[model samples]
Target: MSYPRLAGKRILVTEADAFMGPMLCQVLARHGAEVIADAGTLADDPQRPAAIVAAAGTIDVLVANLAIPAPSTPAVEVSEAEWRATFAALVDPLPRLVGAVLPQMLARRSGKILLMGSASALRGMRRASTYSAARGAQLAYIQAVGVEVAPYNVQVNAIAQNFVDNPTYFPPEVQADPRFQDRLRREVPLGRLVTAGEDAEFAAFLASDAADHFVGQVFPVCGGWVGR
Candidate 1:
């Protein structure tokens, strides 16, 4: 845990206040990275991603930790507005962030892009149609871009997670619910949510030079929920 695996690296973490952002910044910094924690919204402004990248000059890693409250509307009841908003919040900023930071990374022939995605995309979930669709789009984009940039040594990958402890999704009230506990035991093979630190530690590994060989991979951090 004390190893300086990310020593002297400059990392830019987006939406640093939400999702896995806080824990990720803390863990990456603990690993000796100079983390640029940006707690900004990229959904409202299309240009914000570029601005964030421009502001965080010379980034060795980009942690795209974008998130929003998942809409639980049934598939047939999912409105166009809900769909658009979901995509805007979860999927749209990806290319913009990449476009802003990738040229520099490619020029240096080095850099890592780690997306904090969702496991709902990899498995079916009732009342999660909009959220899953957008998340799936994100993973697809990462896969395509990851391969395209891998030859240039710019690795792009994602962590598809669910049943992971985070305020954005599984807050205190939800965790304390008996129904939720029963569901957790019934569905997740691990029998509990994956801790935030565990998830963040894995993310740090992915962002480190140690993970340079991985390309376009979607690592699931869902406590075996996807398997069950």
Candidate 2:
């Protein structure tokens, strides 16, 4: 007996120990989605039970929300080695994770991939060269992959956001500084930071049957920050 609202849907979330990761998993699970806690990536553990897609069986949905810091202190001050490491950490593992289940999704002709991106990537930032570069590249990847899998009924899309209260992935320095908050309030028309559950809610919708028409879409949930 499958539940219509997401009873048997298998959802795999990365960075599970982080604020949004675990929180989204629980929310999805409560909504009837069969949530798979893919927390191994956070530990850098290459051998967790659900470390790879094959191990977790056919995943109905995959949410990749991993983040890494740039090696260089500033864009100008950052070294080549640090840049490479930053991209390596930010981009390299995705193929490994998605590659494992993408084939199966193609075979099944239905699946969804949600990426947690940032608004800075949509519009470049001054000090976030490394991070924004990686995120921009990720957005491009989402577009390409979305088109590639569209024929198979697989949707690949990204959610570009500015501020979510979820602090697990937030850099400590930024949290402590009020200047960033002021700027955020000024730039963001909503006048408040984004909420984690809102993101999870949108993700749930994208993963559901209702979002069949969505593909190659970089949905910006940035509270009007990037729209202007």
Candidate 3:
């Protein structure tokens, strides 16, 4: 029950200002972890690792949460240039950051890396094909690297969240629209949106010994949206 219990542990989180990141940091600190958050959006001028590496010493945990939503339109309507940028912004940076710190952790033989993924990886989201595709690639990458790092006492896993009620990821119009809300309410068995704090708590557990058995896994944090 008291999982996070991350007292004195140092954790690094990217996209600290996003809907879920800061909230997650608070939860980590509440569990006694020393949270270090900085501006590390994959789209930022200087990437995540650059900022994170500069913030402090080597990290005990890393949370990679970056996403780039391509323009909503048919896949046939998307341009090549736009698609390339989306792939880089969504799929590339997280791995680079992980690769950067993973060796250090492996050498020490103790670390947890929780990368943020989406339920869209299960099946593509209607208009957000690019985001889905990028995440799919991310899912594959995490699995491979997770296997390689597990032997070194490093843990890697992805958390796939469905539709969480957050302004940064969801538009204000959509958030307040009762028609759209009712539609999603019917889709998810929980009949409501996933809260960031709840997701953070689960993530904190993954970052702790509580989730030692969770390796190379895609833990669906969605409220039955990606399953029956």
Candidate 4:
């Protein structure tokens, strides 16, 4: 199906080599968006997000696709370093990226910022304290920023997703495991992993003009995993 929802729009997708980045760029481009895929990490170097936005120049949409390998340490065993690192990787770069692009969007009185967040924040998960906390911070930031910028015609929202088909979280080897299949049937109401294309298409809709009415909203794309 042809969706020219984002025709003539320039979108900047961060962490373009990882997480939802690869699929998001492909899908947005298919929807007629000019995607600026930046395969750079925003951790440690605080200046990186701004640098990426500055380089992209005049972006109509910002896809914050930040991610890291989720650490599975138990809550009691999660160290301070683990906590800090997880936040740095998944949470810290958010504001910096928004800060960079928001000025332009606010000035122009038009823009969209879609965060590829996680459902782990909305639902409880064993051995994911640090990772879940960081993801939670991301959603909260989106909610606050979404409302703050909505009046300027700049919408900020998030896709809090899990159980999606992607190399980062659900790689081939993992999906091939029978235990994983059993888990899917037992946990996810959809009884399957949500395809990358399905998730990205929704993201394309959110980034387009069609989704302007939505603000400070968290859309869960977890194949109904969060519902259970």
Better of 2 and 4 by lDDT: 4
- Give the candidate number with the greatest lDDT: 1
**Local lDDT at 22 for model 2:** 70
Q: Going through the candidates in order, what is the number of backbone clashes in each?
A: 0, 0, 0, 0
TM-score of candidate 4 on Cα atoms, chains taken together:
0.98
Q: Which prediction has more favorable TM-score, 1 or 3?
A: 1
Pairs of colliding residues, candidate 1: none
lDDT string, candidate 2, 1-228, tens digits:
223466689998877766468767967887799887766443244343235666678799888877664333666787787677667656666666667678889999989988877666878566678878877888888899999999999998988876776765455677667997787777878866677778778777777888889998998886776344
Model 1, 1-228: lDDT tens per residue? 779999999999999999998999899999999999999679999999999899889999999999999999989999999999989999999999999999999999999999999998998888999999999999999999999999999999999999999999999999999999999999988999999999999999999888999999999998885343
Stretches of candidate 4 off by over 4 Å are 226-228
Order of the predicted models by lDDT, top scorer first? 1, 4, 3, 2
Model 4: colliding residue pairs = none
TM-score per prediction, in order, is 0.98, 0.86, 0.91, 0.98
- Candidate 3 segments exceeding 4 Å error: 1-4, 44-51, 226-228
RMSD, every candidate, angstroms: 1.0, 3.4, 2.1, 1.1
For candidate 2, the lDDT comes to 0.74
Which candidate, 3 or 4, would have the higher TM-score against the true structure? 4
**What lDDT is reached at residue 175 by model 4?**
100
Q: Which tens-of-lDDT digit does each residue in 1-228 have in candidate 3?
A: 454478767888887777577777888988888888865466645355655655657788888877654467688888887788878777768767886777778889988888888878887577777777887888888889899888888889999777775556776787778997887777887877788888888888888877777788998877776333
Instruction: Output the better candidate (1/4) by lDDT.
Output: 1
lDDT of 1 at 35: 97
